[model samples]
Target chain A: MTLLDFARGPAMQFAIFIFVFGIVFRLVGVWAMRHKRDLSEPRQPSAWKGGIHGLIQHAWPYKPFRDKLMTDYVIGYVIHLGLLFVIFFYKPHILFFQDIFGFGWPALPNGVITAISIITIGALVIALVKRLTDPVRRLISNFDDYFTWFVTTLPFVTGLATAGNVWWHYETGLAIHLLSVWLLLIYFPFGKLMHAFWFGVSRYTTGSRFARRGGMA
Target chain B: MSDATTTDIPVDLESKRLTVTRPDIRFDKQGELGDDERVQKAMQHFAKDFGYIAANYMEACVHCGACAQACPFYEANPDPKLTPIWKLEPFKQAYKREAGPLSFFYKTLNLKSKVTIEQLEEWQELLYDTCTMCGRCTLVCPMSIDIATLVGMARHGMFHAGLVPHELYTVTEKAEREGSPLGATPKVFADRVEWMEDEHEVDMPLDADKADVLVLMSSIEIQKYPESMAATGKILNQMGKSWTFHTEGYEATNFGMLSGNTQWQKDMTMKIISTAEKIGAELVILPECGHAYQALRWQGANMLGRPLPFKVQHISEFLAEAVESGAIRVNKVDKSVAFHDPCQVSRRGGATPAPRKILEALGVELREPESTGNLNFCCGGGGGVITIHRADSLRYKIMGNKLEQLDATGAEMMVTSCSNCRQNFDDSGEKLHWDKQMNSLLELVAENLVEDTKS
Candidate 1:
């Protein structure tokens, strides 16, 4: 089979299977763990409200922390928004999603998606630079951190290269992009990328626990 | 803010520097256990602490290291190893190896190693000394990981391993054996109460056969700040509340909770629970202590394996309620004061507004720090760090951040409800040569209490 055909066929199917199976395995594993029931009377009646509050509260930096982490926070938001728009709003990506899910929404202009992708790539690069240079980040970062960064950034770079027709054959570039995408999907459920699913749990636990105690969430 | 003096308490600078000498910890059982046994016990305890919340926290950490910025130890010292998440390295290792969902993968792949005795020894400082478990890191984490809770869990393992700091362990052992970490036994507490009655001319009641309210005091207040006991009596008497100080459950401070001894924590909590139940107390009022409020108000029920029969309120919350309801009145103190929000009481316990409300009722100008209420910085002495003699320099360094925040408020005096926080401020202020007097919210109200005109 040609490289593009292999990328589009068996590799894609296997990647999809692993992604689904692994995520469910992880989610169920986490959910099935022992939960210590808080028997104490709650100061606030509604814990779910606190959970929702926490989900949103963590989206922005607390006031005192904002100025100190301004650059990092900005870069983080940029990278996330860029990945979001490029992955779901780009016409080809939406069409790809439509192929799998049997539905699609109006796609953003290709130019706009491309610009966002580029900006996201820039943010990812800055994030990488900060990770490598910042003392605390560098000390705490392990293989999972750097590897996830590479895994996340590769598809953006390869997709841009393929679409922009930048110094590569279209078939070859597309195959590389597809392969990178598959690699990300396979790794998503295992590595730090799994934060996508667990951040909510973390936030909800904190928000609810604190709110129940009448603490600021 | 105006610099009108709030109190005439003279600054006591002639005292020696804050003690950093390590107390000899009695380790009868721990001494008999081998290193491997300690490690095994630590691993077992860590596994026991494993639950859905801890599992999610471990999985959710993205290594963003934003928690470092929020940590006072890292902020003051700028040491990468002092980063809040880094403090949990060994705990995370234990979790991944023994309890995580992918534990099989981790063990088979050898992704995480078993925690060694040496690592535990090295981590004693990181877990017990440097960290205050102030929950600031938990607040600032982008992933919302409750790093503070994990730290507390890690302490359970550390305690089981007999790796707690000497001073903290000594205090915990004391609280376990003597019921008061500072030697404030039943007899001493009675004497102090009697003394306070004579000294302050307040109607101080001893253990009552049955009462609606049970007033608990920290050993620190009993030994160092006896005025707190008098202040509590004055207020209760003025309000005509049926309250009595029960020697059995008098200790509000729980060094066991501070030192991470869960069993001892339960024992300490149960003492209060049973005592309050014995008296048929409708409410138990915690003294000017932060951890005591947390131990009894929040963790008391969970430790008892059932909900506590009686309600618990911190002294600040009680004062706030009393003043708000006009159950008691206080003469207005015409002075500007900055209120130091205790980490456990305000930030962690959710009594952030209680002290403020009391201050407002007293007609004092409240000069709020930039980081006030639940967002306030810790006094660098919570979480049993105050007792760890080895942590003094680091604790003092961390106090710099709080000092700056408080100084910026430009309030003439500082008032706080937590006796532990007040002691830290007094000690640090003395050593740092900061002239601001650390006043007590309870004392402030007692001194300014308006007499009942009808009487």
Candidate 2:
């Protein structure tokens, strides 16, 4: 089979398997652990509402931290929002989604997606520089942090290169982009990249806990 | 430390100099536990606490470091090691090795090594001394990881390992053994209550049978700030509430919770719980103590493995209700005052409005700090940090942030409801030469109480 064929068939299938299995395994592993029930009478009465509130509230920095970490928050938002746009709003990505989920939504123009991609790549680069320069981030970061950054940024770079036909044939660039996506999928459930899913779980837990205590969750 | 003043010595022709030294604050080792035993105990306890909440929190950290800026220790020292989440390194290590989904791989690869005795010793300061469990980090975390709760859980492991700081360990031991961390024994408490009753001319009830309310006092209130007890008595009396200080469980301070001794925490909580049950109390009013409010109001039921039979309200909450309902009237004082929100009671305990309500009743001009309510800076002395003399310097440094916030308010006087926060402010203020004094909300109300003389 050709490189693009193999990449689109076996590698994609393998990555999907690992992604599905790993996520399920990781989630079940956490759920299987003992859960201590909150038996105290809730000051706010509804834990689930608190949990839902927490999930949405943590999307931005707290007001006091906003000015101090303005650059960090800006870059973080840019990178996240950029990726979200490229994934859901790009035409090719929409086609891929339609192939998998059997549904499609209208796509944003190529110009907008390209602009978002460039900005996202810029933000990703800045984020890496921050991880390397800032003491607190440097101290807390590990192989997981750097590797997740690379895998996350890789898809954007490869997608952009495939679309622009930079330094390779269109088929070859597409295969490379596909492989980078596969790498990200393979590692998503195991590394800190799993934060995409677990962040909401944690926020909900804290929100519910503090909400029950009548805290500003 | 020594002053420039010289002393006259008869034997010597020249004057001699006198030198003074600060009190020695050192770690006191617990029983003859071996390193292996301590490590074993710590790891086992860590595993026991590896529940869903912990696992999710641990997994959720994206290393954004937003929590660092929120942490007063990190802000004061600007040290990466003082980062709030970094303090949980050893605990996270234990979790990954023992209970995480990748536990097998981690164990086989030795990726996360077993927590060593030396590591536990190093973390003693990080887990206990620097952290106040204030929940500021919890509020600021983008992932909502609840770093404060994890720190508390980490302390449980540290306590089991006998790796707690000497001062904290001693205080917890005292509370566990004598039922009071600061030696406010039942006899002492009764005598103090009697003294306050005579001194304040309020009918202070002690060990009353079948009272509707059980009033709890922190050891600090009983021993150091006796006026709090009198103020509580006065408020209850003015409101015509049947309240009594039950000697069996009068101490509101929970050093067990402070020092991370789970059994001791449960025992201390049960003392108050059983006392309220015995007295057939409809409500249990916690004193102006932050952690005490936290220990009893939030964790008390969890400790008892069920919902508490009696209602728990922080003194501020009770006072707020009384004043708002006009059950107790307060004569307005013609002064503007800044209210210091205690970390645990206001930020963590979720009674931020109660103290403000009391301030409104007193009709003082409430000058708010730059950061108020849930986002207020800690007094640098909660979570039993004030009790540890070794942390005094660091605590003082962190207190600078609080001083600036309160000072910027430009209020005439500052009032706080929690005795622990007041104690911290008192200690820091004295050493810092700060002119403003920290006042207690309950006492403020007692002093301005509009007595009910109606037949």
Candidate 3:
């Protein structure tokens, strides 16, 4: 009865499959590249102490894992927290996912959700701008990096348009968001940003090897 | 004692400086390099090697300059020409001129304009002499291309091309012939051990075959740093622990850290491991040399092709180990002194804490500057960069970075865990007008020695 049903063709299904499969391939590649040399540790008394020290340094003044407080890892915490709220609780997302999986959490109130969404969108934009404009951060970014920036912004632009509730415009934004999410999933496994999944294993391996020694002497 | 009374390599307790007025040094003019025919052939060889590495290893750089930001020397200087990529140009051009895609035109038109004797000398100064090849740049390289490894390979190729530096070759040649860089044989090392035993009535064993500890010191200690070596002998004797100094394996200073010549470094490391294994020592303790600590600590197992069966500890680590194990006792230094972070001890080996721990054990008040540990600034002597005569100016510049921190510490003296760092600090401190005294962990530990009669 509505155009919303028309956009739900099988082409979207293929895109979803590519996204999930791409993530798996990335995990396999990173794991395979790790520690080609079977490394050994020299026994030291303070190895574990060193790992604890390093972890503390990384998370210092910012409880990054569970808190939304801006004091710790200011940029990292702010952007990621804003992103989580937007991706999972935006009204259009809840309705779309509710249809896809037949289950959904209550969406945040429309005004509150959009407010949070705009804040997140702003943070991400600043981050992308920083990467391009900042001399040091720009030098460190790569081809895959720019690709991530472009694709992320596309979802937000479409979602804002779809938010007007202008007769099926919401469905249009939902479709764009889903497609972007899928593309990101697929690209995840191929890039240096793959470090997200890979770094845990790398850190743990480095930690445990040196942990047994109590940290480097 | 006055500077006039100080020996050629002085042990001046008064000025709290090692007053060594070392002869002016150069690394390029030695060997078959001086002969025109050999130099020409060397040039051909240089061109080929430089061409191969640049095309194969360097051609892919995005020039993002991320690596330049990582390099401490580049960060300190901010000069584009001083950057790692630009540093390779002179060498890379040598390759382009000899065997590059357009070498034919170069050959016809004497396209060798890109390669020159003075340019070669300048590259030698910048790449070999000034640049420490610290490898920090490689970590920041998105390509993960290890510029330091490339530089070392370049050094090895340069050696094969007969362009070895006299500064390191002079030491390596001595090490090759005498089993010590001081031109001392096993007899000289043994004699020092004997002298320690007689003076202190402690029977410090020589070639204590199958001892539990293989104590390796540098030529600096054997020849000039005796008060420190005496402290070591004192500690080992007090512990009554199983330890020996291998007369043959006496020198632990690996030139790999200097020249980045991996094979030669491997040869030097293997000698220590074999000496330790032969003596059946469970511990291989490296004395106070920055690059020596790195070669053994970071590169030991790789150089040996397996896990080092014996443990490697820096002298500071060993001293801290002794303090931890209750083998040696020390009195408080009782004066405020700052610690200088050696690039090897702090950054490369991650052994910064051991000295701090030992200094704490001695109750020496440690006055730290803003940046002390792994984020440490270099002491200007690493990567064999100290020996290039042209870098005398740069040496003063970098050392001034340390001297500024030393000034801020407001301390009477500075203690470091490296001989070269101490050497650089002592020489440059006096030259650069920084009033603070510069000394080593060994010298401080020696002066604070408390003979643990209990052990």
Candidate 4:
């Protein structure tokens, strides 16, 4: 098979299987583990409110750490929301979803999607620069952190290359973008990217635990 | 005076310094030193101790660095190692290798470095001395990682590895063997209570069979600040509450918590629970000791495998409830004061509003700092750091952040509900030559009690 065909077929199937299976396995395994009962009576009656509060409250920077994290917070939100918009609303991306699920949502205008993709690439670059330059971020970051950043940024870079038809044939750029996405899917469950699933669980557990004690998360 | 001038309580700076710097007793190293066997044991403990919430926290952290900004230790020194999440490196490695998704890969490839004795030795300061387990980092983490909970889990691993600081190790050993961290025996506690009773001209019910409340005191209050005990007696008496100090479990502070030994923590908590049960007390009152409140009120039920038969309340919480219900009447004091929220009681234990209520009842002009209530800075002497002699300089250094907050308040008197916090303020206040007078909230309430009942 040609490189493009293989990248579009077998590699895509393998990546999806691993992404779905690996996430489920890890999450279920975490849940299956025996948790010691919190025998202490809660000061507050229900922990669910705290858990729900935590899910929403953590979306923004906590008040005490607000000033220190304002820049990261703004850039991070733009990158995350922009990527979501591009993934779900772009015509080509929705076509892939429609092919699998037999349904698709309304697509954004190609020009708008292109603008968001470019902005996302810029945000990711800025994030990478901050990770490399800021002393605290640099200190805590490991090889996995940089690797995840690189893999996540690749599809965006490749998509922009295809859209603008820069540096290579448009078909080749599209093929490379598809391959980069496969790499991310396979790498997602093994590294810090697992935080996508764990963040909600962590925040809910924490919020509930603290709420039960009559404190906000 | 603008309610900001109060007489400085004459403190013998030199002797007080000596009491903290040179404790009368020393903790001799007890067990075998850290070795390969100990490292393996610690790694095993890390694997065994973690449950669902801990695993979630371990995997959820994205290295956002928000926690580092909230940590007083990191803020004081700006050291990367003192970063809250960074301090969890050892525990994280053990988790990755043993229980994580990539454990099989780690076992087959052996890519990670082994947790060495030297590394564990170095981490002693990071885990025990530098960090206060104050939960400030837990509060600021965007992922809600509960870094402080995992820090305690790391301490549990360290404790199993025999890597606890000598000071904490000795104190835990003493508490395990002698029933008190300070070696205050049953007789000693009884004598102090008798002396305070005589001094205050009040009857301190001792181990009464069926009292409505059981009052528990820290060994520090008995040995160092007996006036707090006297003050508690006065308040309880004025409220017409039936309370007794149980000789069997009067010591509220648990060194087990300080040392991170789960078994010891369970044992100490059981002692208090059993004593309260034996006395048929309806409620148990923890003194102005922060960790004691954490040990008894928060972790007590989990340790005992059941909910406590009697309710546990911090003295501040009890007083707040009393003042709110009009069970106790107090004349407002004409002084400007800043209330220091103890980490264990306010942030960790969820008693933030109670102390503020008590302060309002006192009628003092309350001055709040940039960080107050749940986000208050630690007094730097918590989590057994105060007991570790070698950690003195680091503690004093970290106190810079708290001192700056208090200074900004411009309050004449600084009042806190925790004895450990009070000791920290006293020691650091003397060293920094701070002018604000340090007072206990319970004592202040006692002094300002209204004798005539309007009802």
Sorted on DockQ, highest at the top, how do the candidates line up?
1, 2, 4, 3
**Residue B87 miss distance in model 4 (angstroms):** 0.9
Please give the C-alpha DockQ score of model 4. Answer: 0.72
For model 1 the interface RMSD, in Å, equals 0.9
> Chain A only: TM-score of every candidate?
0.96, 0.96, 0.71, 0.95
Q: Which of the CAPRI classes, incorrect, acceptable, medium or high, describes model 3?
A: incorrect
Model 3 chain A weakest 10-residue run by lDDT: A60-69
What does candidate 1's lDDT look like per residue over B1-455, in tens digits? Answer: 01111111121223222122323322222344688988998898888878888899998999999999988898889989999999999999888877877889889999888899999988888998888878889878887888888888898988887777655666676678788777788999999999999999988888899999999999888888899999999889888889899888899888788878899999999899999999999999999988898888988899999988988999999999999999999899998999988888887899888998999999999999988888888888888887666777887887777888888988887899988888888787877888787889999999999978563
**Candidate 4 segments whose C-alpha is farther than 4 A from its true place:** B1-30, B452-455
**Model 4 residue B147 lDDT?**
82
| DockQ, cand. 3 | 0.05
Q: After aligning candidate 1 to the native by TM-score, how far in Å is the CA of B381 from where it should be?
A: 0.7
- Report interface Cα RMSD per prediction: 0.9, 1.1, 9.9, 1.3
How does residue A40 of candidate 1 score in lDDT?
80
Looking at model 4, residue B312 earns an lDDT score of 92
TM-score of 3: 0.70
* Comparing 1 and 3 on TM-score, the stronger one: 1
- The model with the greater DockQ, 3 or 4, is 4
